[model samples]
Target: MAEALQPGDPAAIGPFRLTARLGAGGMGQVFLGESASGRRVAVKQVRPEIARDPGFRKRFRREVDLAMKAGGFWTAPVVAADPDAESPWVASQYVPGPALDEHIAAQGPMDEAAVRRLGAGLAEALDSFHRIGLVHRDLKPSNILLLDDGPRVIDFGISKAMEDGGGSALTSTGMVVGTPGFMSPEQALGAAVGPASDIFSLASVLVFAATGEPPFGHGASHALLFRVVHAPPRLDGVPPGLVTTLDKCLSKASEGRPSAHEVGAMLTETAAPAAGRPAAEVDAGGIPFDVRAPSPAPESAPTAPNPRAAGAPAQGTYIAPARRVPPPPPAVAPRIPVTPSAVHEFAVQDGGPAVFRRRIRKSALWTALITAVLCTSTALIGQLLAGVFLSVIAILVGFLPRLVGALPLLVRSSLRIDARVLQMRLGGTAFTVTWQDVALVSVSRTGNTLRLVVVLHSDAKRPVPAPLRRPGADDDREAEFLLISWNDQAVTSRAARLHATLAAAAGPAYRPPVRG
Candidate 1:
């Protein structure tokens, strides 16, 4: 920064007299200046070294033009610009507020409402630039002022007009132009960007306001670029409503994101949820909230099904209950390997409209059963010599079938998706459900461990649904539900696919809940 000066310091330029040095950046110094009309302004002058370069002056001229025209409620109004002078300068109305980065460092992160206000205001500001075919290539938290009314985005020195073609010579190597933590994937790659690129940056800014850090956060520029290109945004404590919208904006592919206008509408519509008292009330006109598709019944299997047929209306008729099978018992002992193709195949497909089950290789069940029998018989024969051996064999054989069935069940539960009907196949029987007939899935904490409970929807006319116990839960239902414990990323993706299938048949768009 230049030396702080007092009144009448004789650093006057044109009608404005420089009062004090406010701050300095790589390109220029910002001075506190007062115009002849008694208006305060922050004047920035091009560095002397860069001033001699003709190319730099042209770029500086473009920045001046962008600042002059880019007027909005969420931006400090431009006061004056002189590109033809000895040292080019631009002055904007002096705003008395801390930079967003400084505000967060001084007083933690703003709460949800403040973050929302910041997002909406910034969205409106970006919309103004986007509407006129301009891109503010730099939009880091430091460039935003946290005012009492809302945020005001400043520093359009790198803003590029579509008519001006692309970035200036400063980014000649296809190098990124914006701050690393806030740059979109396209911007990081030095690719031509449209309005979505700014939307991505805007999302990064919101993340910073909500969490006191950008999604990519503090790191070397190259590392940050890698995260921007391939990693998910790290939003550990952000509100759920904003998370999905932020995720959309920070998509790796530019086309996957919504425009600035869509972001503004989302912020506006999200406010309506607060008007209602219920916490988890279904939003009537908000974004779609479909989860998983309803499972198809066995009798509805299509005959001569068309491979490319449109989804058929899901026949939702409930099936009459026979005997409900218990979950397979826990694994007790290891057994002999069985030959392939030893067990009969059963059609048990689920969650489809027409085709419910399909024939799959039956080798796995055979292998499990054969191993169980061998382990059981070995201990049983030895028990004749010693009665104590009998206890061991009984324990081993009793739980064999249950163990065989449970391995697949555990795999399916780890999927992080809400299913309409959860299905589990035990030996000789299958358990299917209509969503309304299902109760809550419980997560409980006991000591240092966590447990899960699948509480069935108790019905008046039907047999009680089996209580599926989590392995470590011991039938408790209060443990923290780890979304990844049962259904991992792969299973969640599968659930999404199922939901899409059912939604197609139902004639409504579907959007899943925000993943925790």
Candidate 2:
């Protein structure tokens, strides 16, 4: 419930008439106000002390800009603002719901489904903030409104545009500006923050919604900050399904945490269906909120004739005939293994037997040689001891590239195409792709570089070794391998052969590229 305006409160702010005091904070007083057109708004009048400061006025204007840029389903849209007023104030759409903290205190902790919905809604809101180059430096339970439809993120008081160097001079250096319990580790240590910091705060907020307690638990401001920076979150009562994703969100390293979009996807995928349906039904995407009472027993199953009926002529007469037994399922054929094909082979000039290998292109070798010659010539003209040091550096600069390019050839591995799997080994890492796991194998071109993208079935479980994992290839649905290139030349011929080999091995799972 909103508090009626006190005697000291102003009657009006700009054209909006103040009716009630919603709340007050360190920064200002929030009032329940009505516009001249009669629409309700929540107007936050900045404290006179803060308004008097030039730095605060600049930050207030920045906050208004950020709020204006963040109009979405889960964010309270900024309706108006008057930074030039004697006491600066900003008004936003009045969301008709209690703060998340207040709601949880009034009611008990939210169930798994409600918490998931909240996570998805808040993740989407954070995505909006990120898209517009803003980071909500202060995201906590009190900043989220628990509306009937979904959560609405409010209060951009401490938010900063990413391009504006995070915060104003007042918050620069050692000054920390976020709520203690909700601060990310980097924020707690006065380190630079980005969109990922908001994700960490979001995870904390979800923990609070699920268990009616912050992830770090309550403590002195400094203690809580230390826990946030060093201790693991106390997620004892959080739902198991949400724990994994939230754990990733709360990763100490910002890079380890999933982006807001990824978090939304993971939460939406794992969220339980609404109440009243069996768990299996929910998993299968069956009717949600199936609250109709169970059907009567008589209608649920067909009535079988009673064995004790009177005047039953014979065993087969009144008694239903024995149900026909289902025939045994057809036998499945065993998979036949084909001999591995050796399409290419290379032998070391030294004493090794012939082996299939990918060789470094001659152009790359020549380039390295040229670089080495240039470095050596530069070194010879330098001082005596410096020349010796520079010469060693020059030798390494030239040899490293050629050594790296040739390292794969030294690995004891084979690329085999057979009925059961496509096996390849480079260095110590091995990749085995079973036919059943293959969804699609195709070759694609980006500029001059050709790539072989192998998409796996959604249900497939093939673990890619750390060395084999590409930069963004940790996504479970697909893996990519770079095709061999010579100088700037396209490896069209080699890529075609590789594609054909993989397609033959993948059988029906292979998708051929469309001819243009």
lDDT winner among the candidates? 2
The C-alpha lDDT values of all candidates are 0.58, 0.68
Candidate 2 structure quality by residue, lDDT tens digits, 361-468: 453465557656656676677645655565556547655565565564455544545557766565566788787887777767665455556777888877655655
In each prediction, how many residue pairs overlap at the backbone (N, C-alpha, C within less than 3 A)? Answer: 16, 0
- Candidate 2 off by > 4 Å: 274-516
Each prediction's RMSD over C-alphas, in Å, is 24.9, 21.8
What's model 2's lDDT at 154? 85
Tens-digit lDDT string for candidate 1 (254-363): 89989887898887676632332223222232322112122222464322322213554233211111111222434742111121321212212222222211111243
TM-scores, one per candidate: 0.50, 0.53
